[model samples]
Every structure is written in C-alpha cells, then in structure tokens.
Target: MNNLDLIVVGGGITGAGILREAVRNGFRTLLIEQKDFAWGTSSRSSKLVHGGLRYLKEGHFGLTRESVKERERLIREAPGLVEPLEFRLPVYERRKPGRWTMGLGLALYDLISWKWNHRYMPRNEFLQNVPQVDPRGLVGGFSFSDAQVDDARLVMRLIKDAEMNGGKALNYTRVNKLLRNSSGKIEGVVTEDVETGEIKPFHAPCVINATGVWAENLHPSPEKNKHIRPLRGSHLIFPWELIPITTTVSFFNAQDGRALFAIPWEGSVLVGTTDIDHGNSLTDEPRITQGEAEYLINSLNHTFPGLKLSLNQAVSSFAGVRPVVSEGNVSADKESRDHVIWKDKGLVTVTGGKLTTFRVLAYDTLKACLDMLPHCNLDAISEPVFESRRSITLSHTVSETVLRSLWGRYGKETLTLLNESDEQDLETIPGTRTLWAEIKYAAKYEKIRHLDDLLLRRVRIGLLLSKGGKDYVGRIRSLCENVLPWDNERWELELKTYFMLWDSCYSPDAFQNFSR
Candidate 1:
C-alpha cells in the first residue's frame, strides 16, 4: 500500500472506471468504498446506457455524441449486459415538439452514431407496436434505439475486471481523513472499516475523489457559487403483466412538460425519473416522495390511460441523487451533465457526469493526474475497457440467454460460476431474470458484506420483487447459508435489518406510509 501509484475513492462507476484504466496502464491502484459498491446513485439509476437524446434538445450535441459513441462501444463489447433497447416516443396533437421537429432530432441522433435506427411510425403501426399507449391524441411516434443495463452489475463488472488485472478494491471501507504533506498537499488517505471500526492509513502519490454526490465532502468546488447540486431522480418498478410494453415508451408529462419514460427492464416495467432538488441529507437512503410518485403515476396514466397504473400496482420503488454541478440559477433538469475535474496538488476530484461516459470521465481524470504520476500511460485509454470476450462452454445445457447474461456480468468468471454451482441453482428466480445461482455466487465471491448487498445491488431481486422479495427470503438464505459467514443469530439480525431497510427505502408502500 505504501508504494501505491494511485488510490480511488467512491466505488461507483466513475471510481471503478478510473481504477480499471489505472490498472490497465500498469499502475498500482486501490479503490475503497464507504458503503457497498454502487450503494449510491450507481445502483439506483434509470438503468439506461443511452445517448442523452434530450441533450440534443438542450444544444449539448457534444455530450450526446460522446454518449452515443460510448453506448455503441458498450453494446459491441458487452452484449448481454448492455443490450439494445428500442424506444418509442409517441407524438400528441398538441404536444410541444411536433412530428417534424422530433424527426429532425432523431435524424441528428442517428447521424451522431452513424446508424440509421430511427423511423417515424404512423398511428396505426405505433398502436400495433404499443397497444397500451393512450390513443386519444396520438399522432404516431418516433422509434429509435438505445441500451439498458443492470447498473450495479456494470459497476461490479468494472471493479472485478480491475481486480483481475492486479488492482485491489475494498467495500464498506470509509476514508475518514485525507493526509497531507507540509505544503498542504494531499499525499494519502486514512481509511476506517465500517463494520470492524478498524483504522488504517495508505499512501499514494495520486488520489482521486470520484465520490459522485459526496465529492464535495472530500474536495469543495473552487469556483464561486459553483457546487454539486444533489438532484433526486426516483423510479417505480411494476410487474410487466400490469403495464406490458415491448419497447420503452417516452412521453412528456402534461403537468410540467418534462419528458418521462416507462421502460421494459429485466422482467418488469420500470417507470420513472422525476428530477427535483433532493433537499435531504446525503447519508439517508433516497426514496420516492409521495408527490414524485403521484407525478410519475399521473404521467403513466396520461400515456397509458387504458392501464390506469397506480402506486399499489408497483412492486418496488427507488431513488438516486444525481451529483449535478450547478450554479444555483437553473432548474434541476436544465443543469449540465458534464463532469468537472479540480486538482489540488496530489488530489484530483472528478464529478458530475452521466453513466454512459464513464470511460471518458476516467480518461479525463487520469489525464489530470498525469503531472503527479509521471510513469502513468495516458495512451492506454484507447484499449478496450474490458477483457476480450472468451468462449464459454458448460457441461450442462444452459440457454444462450442465460450464458450471455453470465458472461456479460461475470466476464471470464462465468465458467467458474457454472462449474461451482449446483444444478438446481441454474434455475431462474421465479420473478426475475436473475438465476438462483447468482445469489450463491455473489455471496461467495462478490465481496458481499450484508444480506441487502446480496439481494438489492448484486442481483436486484429486492427491486424486482413485491414486498422486496420477502417470500423468497427463506430460499435465498438456504442458498447463501454456507457461503456467507452469518450464523443463526447473525442471519436473523441480517434479515431484520434487510427487511427494515427494504420497507423504508425500496417498498412502493413506503411512500404511502411516509406520507402518513
């Protein structure tokens, strides 16, 4: 640790990406997270790896182009995890953006990626594709391609890949203090294990703060009035049976004219993303407020009047605070999604970027650190973010879909997971795309520190199931009993803690109870 070339804080996508790139360049790097990996905004995103189509409307064509390029690269390199998703934006008779205007935007969007994947669908064809859409004022729609991913798994993939390439990562390890030299220059960090309360210090020539919303805590903005604006974006997950749609349906909310989406993710329909000032402490787990829930529900009802979606129909809800850097003059959605880097001698704080451009953020952050680590190679950014794809063959007959998923999430570790798993573990979870084996695999290998880590971020069953997968807790415990180091009493305590967390943070009913 004393000879480390770099240290990365935060364990989100940005931190993980930086660690991976640093390791690829043969730098001795270590990444430490205050909580579980992706315990913050990374796990709670809208689950899109999309080129910010709306950015084009805001005249941020450069951001859109970078995101589009990254989106295409991820689709090519990580197939199963970052799979292609079709999006359909239905046009209304009185909507602000008419057909011609939307067509122009889509044309530019396609031109950026050099892919002609967008087309104007007539009302009849649009209805045939999305019958659940409200047809009252429907004037056809625009179809385009984007991508989706298991957000937490993507973070885990980057971290695991980095570890495989000779980097180290620690979860639930908090950096209590930044160490500095005589000239008031940062030199290293003092870390404390959250669970054990054990304190230790590590030295590095260059340290990076990629803590997203918490970046300001480690390194404040040097500019006047420029600060990290914590904007909370919340989402509701419903069973696909309730609001079945093959492609994502993006529409504008009549109440505020803000664009929202109802996307098909995993085995459920994810409707989200109300952006507003958080106005809450960063330490507390974010949850959907009652007003935000109603706002999203109203948008869904307006778009799919036939479905009549409600909060009660939703299986779960989640909220993540965006680390948007703002000047306190613009609306929440009007803020830029671009990342910024501030260097204070040996410390480089990189914050405020979209998930789609993480690699770009990583390269930029490392380039900022080049002055401190003269041995680091900046050209390594051109290399692939992940290891080359390996051909995985199993003795048992597993579906191509499942194998692809395992490869995308686990990479080279897929064969080991399949080899070490019991045959029964190969079965998919009753209500999720997650395999039962994944629970065991994560418990044994994914550095899981708690039951919530296993269910919530690792496999996402907590977000996909009703009552936060309460019914399957027994089976989950059985699968992970030997793998996790929890005894009976510890198991009971974990269950109590996990259910309490789920009830307060992840349950859709939590909003109703909170409103009371």
Candidate 2:
C-alpha cells in the first residue's frame, strides 16, 4: 500500500490540470489513467483554445469571458503551443446571425479580452483570403482572433510539469473502485494495471474524480435530477492541399444552422464537429458515424462549394464524448459547457468543462477540495500554470520555429531532448510538424506502454498523416527500437494492435463499415 495526499482518477486535461495544481500547492498527488494520456476527449477536441465566441451568442457570458481570458493567458505563456489563430466568419444573406450581430458579438468578445482584434472584411478581400468559400451570397465576413493548441501535447505538458514538481502519474492504470473507511467515507483507491492485471492499493484522504465522461461511474452526481450527458463531437481531417485555407474558417451549417469550423492544424485541415448524443458504450472507443461524416462533408461542401470536398478525401476521422451536465430538457447543443464540482465526504468529483479553461477548472476543483487539504496554500491557485524558466540556449543549427515548438511542448526538458538527438533527428518527419527526435524521447521517457501512445498522443503523426502514419512505421520503429524495450515478437504484436486500433477508430472507412 502507498500513502499519498491526493489521487486524481483521470489523465485528460482536467485531471492533468488538477494533478499539476495540487502538486504545486504542496500536495503529494498521483494521477492514474485507464488508457493513454489524453486518449479521450482531450486529444479528440477540435483543437481550438478560444473564448467560445458562439457561447457569447448563446448568452454564456461567464464561460466566454473566462475562456477568452484563458485564451489570452495561454497564448502569452505558451507561445508556440498556443499561438494566436485568426478566425474568419463569413456572412451570408438571410443568415441567422447576420453581419452586424456577429460584429457586435466579436466586439464583445474583444472587449472581454481587452483587445481590438476583429474587423469586417469586404467580400472581395475575404475571397482573397479564403478563395474556396462559397460566394453565391457574396456577403463579407468578420475576422477575429482566437488561439489553437495541440490538445494532447498540452495535457502531456501539464502531466510532465506535475511530475517535475514531485507528483506521480500512472498511465494504463485503472481505478476499479473507491476504498472507503469504516464510516463509509472515501479513504483510498484500488487500482488495476491494465496490461499486467496487477492490483494495488493507494491510500489518500483526498481523492478527486476528474474522470470527465466516466466521472459518474466513480461518484454519482449530487443533483439527482441532473446527470452527465455524453455528447459526441466528431471531426474529419483532410490534406491541407484539399482545403487550403490560411486561417480558420468559421461558418454555420445550412442544414441545421449549427456552428462549424474548418481549421488548418499541424499541416492538415481539420473540419468537424457534429454535436449529437453519444449512444455507444463508454468503455469502447468513440468513432465518427456515417451519418455524422456525411453531415460534416455536406457542411464542408456548403461552406466551400468551389472545393466540392467529399468524404473520401478525409484522411482520418475521430470522435470524442463531452461530459456535459444536463437536465435532459434541452438539446445536446444547448447543454451547458460549465463544469460542476461535487463533494461527497472525502471524494470530490469535477467534470464538464472546455479545454481552453482547464486552468480555471483546476483552480475550482482545488478550491472545492481545500478543506480536505489542510497544508495547501490558497495563494498557489493564483500562480502561473507553467513554471517560468530562463531562456533556452541551443546550437545555432536549431531553427527558432523548432526551438519555440520544443520549448512549448517539453519546457525544461527541451535541452535534454535536443542534446540526446542526432543531427538528422532534428528534422521534422515528412508531412508533419513532429520531429523524429520526439519519437525517441517519448518512447524512452514519456511512459509509452504502447505504440499508439507514441504515434497518437506524443507526436500526433497518427492523426496528421494518412493511414495513421502507417507508411512511416519502419522509420519510427528504427528510431525508437533502442529506446523502447520491445522484442521482435512484441514489436509485431504492437504494430498489429496499433494498425487494427487505427482502422477501427480513426480511419474514415470505419464510418462506412459502421453504417453497414
């Protein structure tokens, strides 16, 4: 049995954030995840770190304000990882939210962040920027500032920071059940290793159930009438050349008038996200349905009629279940994105929030669990999310762009990763922003128990490249063989497993099979 001050029961952004905050506040924290880090909704997000501009139109001023503030903070703190992304919202004739309504909303969005970064672009100018957009209506558009991030990298960075501050984390570890004291209060947890099937007990007075969609399984919601509603948001990733827009294009779907986006990320154009109730079992990996895929494809064609994009052009598809607390009265899209914190004796459950406001969620969770932690410093909640380090000094051969990216992802470990890499390792993998050195570093140090964790989360080539980067398996294996302790038999098994998993969950063809 191991004793600790706090144990977080999830490895997504919310749980990672809690672990980092708790460790900084002088708590001996440990985070346990059933699967790979950010394998759930965190990694499958639309990859926007914005103020939820649509929320403002929905009258969620508080969420929009907090998200906007956090967006600015992340862009300032993590420059390369959370860079400013300009969004172009094309106006169409007889649209629900016309030009002035969007202009006022953008004005308020700018006002919340104290930056005047939005302007109305004429139709010709907008066409000059996004030539593929549908021009039948021939209306102008509004350009505004937001931010984007590597969702998995952000979660990994938070976990890495927590570990650096003496906190511990275990991936591929499942907390089977909560251990309770004689008085029926939560005391510890019984965890099972997903790979080895070894069960272990860890004692902690303060246990936080930041498990996102799976939170209710650990601790039921305090509100009997309200429950965690699993809403699926699916996305499609296409080759950049197919939908080559320099900036993010935000538009509304003509079929349902729902907000949709076409974002350029990591050398690919990401289009998605259909918001609908997820009816699949939570234990299985969420996949994009054929109906959802066709809906997204139709939206793309509606927005960019010139491109005439088809579903077959998408290289990959992914779906994630958002833990939305719902009263079961409104539609899935209308459900609130605000987080809820429930405390039952020693156990505190936190769920339902956006990726952009993870820090706020962390702070709020800590505040909720403050009474359980007597040694915690309240002031620590207001501290910077990341540690401020001295400027990195590296060889002149490393470009400023690569250095910034490495710093944002690895922080203090950037120098070590660079020092350990060969000259050729510094070059990025073809068709992706990830460097070959990242594979070696993650395999050796990032607790990669499986090949999917490396290709999917650590570097994200799995989603960026076709066939989940299957073509580069030989190169990746050569790069990581020395670092990873896998024999030939194990390597073959891992490759088979990874490719099977990718086909079932990530490939666009999966949707076709699923519909059949």
Candidate 3:
C-alpha cells in the first residue's frame, strides 16, 4: 500500500482547495471524486463570488468579513476566472428595508469589501441600465460591486494547478469503505475505480471528508452523525432576448421573503435560487421542482413587470443540495452559512459553507486535522500559491473579447490550446462564448469519460443551451471522438444517457412532477 500524508475526499471546491494547499506545503496529498470534478454543488452554484450581501443582514459579520476579503483576493489572484459584477437592488413601496435602508447596507458592504464601486442609482439612471424593469413605484436602486465566476472552471483550474505542484487527483473513483487500525485510530481508506471496477487500499495518516451533503455516509457510527440538513436550491436560465438585462437585479420574493437574483450570464439571463428543505431520495440527482420554477418566474415577473416571464421561456434549470449544518426545526434559509469541522472515531468531516468562503474552510479543515499527524511538520502548512502573472500576445486576427475569454478559461494553458487548434476551433459556439477547442481540450486532458462530463461539466454548453445543447452533439462528437476514443455504439449509448439525465435532472419540465 502506498502511504500518503493526506487523503481529501470529494472533488468540490472545498476538497480542491485543501488539495491545492496540502501539495503546496509538501504534503503528499490525494483527492478522489466519485464522478467528474465539480459534478456536485460546486458546478451548480449561482456562479457569483460575492461577499454574501444577505449574510450581512443576518448579522454574520465574521463570515461576511472573511468572504469579502477572500472575494477581493480571488479577483486579484484569478482575474481570468473572476470578473467584476455590478448589481442593482430595486426598491419599491411594498418592499421592506426601502431605498435609504438598503443604502446603509451597501455602505457596510463596501466597508466590508475594503472598498467598492458603491453608488445610489436614481430611478431614471436605473431605468437606463435595466429598461425592462417595471418603473412603476420603483424608487430607484442601489448599485454595488461584486464578482461573477466560472464556478466549474475554477474548480478544474485549481485541481490543475495542484497537479502542477505535485498533487494527485482522480475522477470517476470512489472511497468504498473506511480503514481503521486495531486501536481504532485513523489509518487509511479503501477505494474503488468506478470505471474498471478495481478495488485498492491505500494508507494515509489523515482522511478529510469534504463530501458536502453526503458526508454522513462515511461516519463509523451513522446514528451520531446526523447534522446535515440538505437544502435544495434551484435556478433557471433564459435567453437574453427574452429578458435583456446588463446587471444583476436583486429582488425579495413577496411570497416567502427569500432573496432572488436575476443576473445576466453567458449572453443569457439567469434567474434563480429557491431555498427549501429537500425531502426526497438523496441518491438521485437533484431537480428543480415545478413550485421552484413558478416561484422564480413570479419573482422575475414581479421585478420586471413588463417582461411577464413565463416558465416555458426557461432554457434550462438546475438544482444542487447544500450540505447545511443545522438541528431541530429551524427554517432552511436561516441555517448558518458558517462551516464546521469535527473529528470522529477515525475520519474528519468538513461541511456547511458557501462557495465564496471555500478557501477559508479548507484552511480551517487542514489546521484542525494537522495535529492528528504528529510526524508532519506544522510549518509546512502555508497559504495557497496563486498563479503567477504572465504576458502573451495573440494573433491580431483573434478579437480582444475572444482572447480575454480564452485566457480567463485556460490561464497559462491558453497559448498551448490556441497554438494546437485549427481556425474552426477559434470561433465561439453559436449561442455561447465557449469554443469548440474547449471541448476538444477537455476530452484530451480533463478525464472526460462520458459525453455529459464534456458538455455539462467541462465547457457548460449543456447548461447554456436549450435541450442541453443537443444541436451541437454531432459537432462535438466529431471534434472529440479521437480524443475520447468512443466507438459508435458507446457514443450512441452515452448520448442517450446524457439526454435522459439532462431532461430528468436539468430541464424545466423536470419540475412538472412537483407542480401538484
């Protein structure tokens, strides 16, 4: 058995962060994911790297402070992945915490962010930015600075960087059982290769469970490990033409008082996020319920009364189960966004945090578990290594927008990807800024075992297009068939499986079952 210093389970942002830091500090670290990287809550986020403006209202100053600082740091460290975003919070007579009150919140938000492009937009100025918004009873709004990110790409890039620094990451592999020494102190893990059905055992001094909502399963005593209260958050995406908007609009739902965000994303408008207790089988993929679709549609209709957005206009929908920590009968929305790390008979489970604060969570998890490995040098743990600045000039034929997009997605690898691609791969997909070369690159290097992993997780053409971007399936297969080495039968079966999964797990129609 190959003994390792650390074994981080779950390939979400939290585990990725831990793996990066561990390897940077000279610890032999291994990260394993049951499916593709970022296939869980990480990829399905709202894709914002904000300081949790809502958290400030809930009086979580500590979380807000850490998040804002990390948010700014990420913006500077990974400018290619994180872009500055402007948000507008429209005020109405019926809405509580009216204009002036919200203005106070923005002031605090800026203070927390160290500094921000915070300003109050008068009704006319706001209307200019969001013309589709219903100007009736609208008392202007407050504009503030945050950021948006390619959530899935961020995870993949972090893992890539970790690998560059000597970390090992495996996708399509799972930890089938936990190993314990005779004394019952933590020893190692038993893993299964999901593809080859091979079982293997490895020794490690520390095993960190960062498996989000699924953390409960690995506990030796399942009865005592019942902290997770899975909250399902669902989102809807629409064509930009139908709901044109330049900035994110924050609205408070009249029905449940939940905050909703309708933002412009990937040349489309993304409106989402409903938080409710998930009372279903946790084994299957999460889906947006019919009530969630209606709720989001109604929230958008209320905010942009002129648009009258309907459920049918939704190009696609997605849902992710949050591994929130809670007890008793508290409302799901009210659960603390803070994370917790606790050691058990042999394993350490870390869960309950937001995407914006994943780095901090990783730091804390490492600090908590380091003492367990007495032989390890404490000084080895340090800050994560940020990508170094590099200058590259591209061909004049490549437009500035495309060049920037490529760098943002590929970072240092942009040059190699561009140099290897033909002219056809340089062009963007019809409806999205993603390029054909991205699909090819993922197939060749990103461990894409299935068509869904390529379209859905690798490039996001699946979520960005209607019917999960089926129109481009033939083009994609042609581009990546050589790299993926899929036979015609395998390709057909994978395509069929991809479509079935998408329709059942990521389509607006998936919500119809919850309508009644």
**Candidate of highest TM-score:** 1
Judged by TM-score relative to the true structure, which candidate is superior, 2 or 3? 2
Residues 290-365 of candidate 2 have per-residue lDDT tens digits of 8898899988998888888887788998899999999888988888899999999899999999999999999999
Taking all chains together, each candidate's TM-score versus the true structure is 0.98, 0.98, 0.95
Cα lDDT tens digits for candidate 1, 10-85: 9999999999988888889999999999998999999899888888888888889999999999998888889999
Q: Rate the local accuracy (lDDT) of all candidates.
A: 0.91, 0.90, 0.83
Instruction: State the lDDT of candidate 3 residue by residue for 124-213, as single tens digits.
Output: 998887888778888788888789988888888889888987899999889998889888877888899998999988788889999988
Which runs of model 2 end up more than 4 angstroms from their true locations? 514-516
Q: What is the lDDT of residue 511 in candidate 1?
A: 66
Say which candidate scores most in lDDT: 1
The TM-score of candidate 3 is 0.95
- lDDT of model 1, residue 104: 94
At residue 123, candidate 3 shows an lDDT of 88
Provide the global lDDT of candidate 1 against the true structure: 0.91
Ranking, lDDT, top scorer first: 1, 2, 3
Clashes of 3: 0
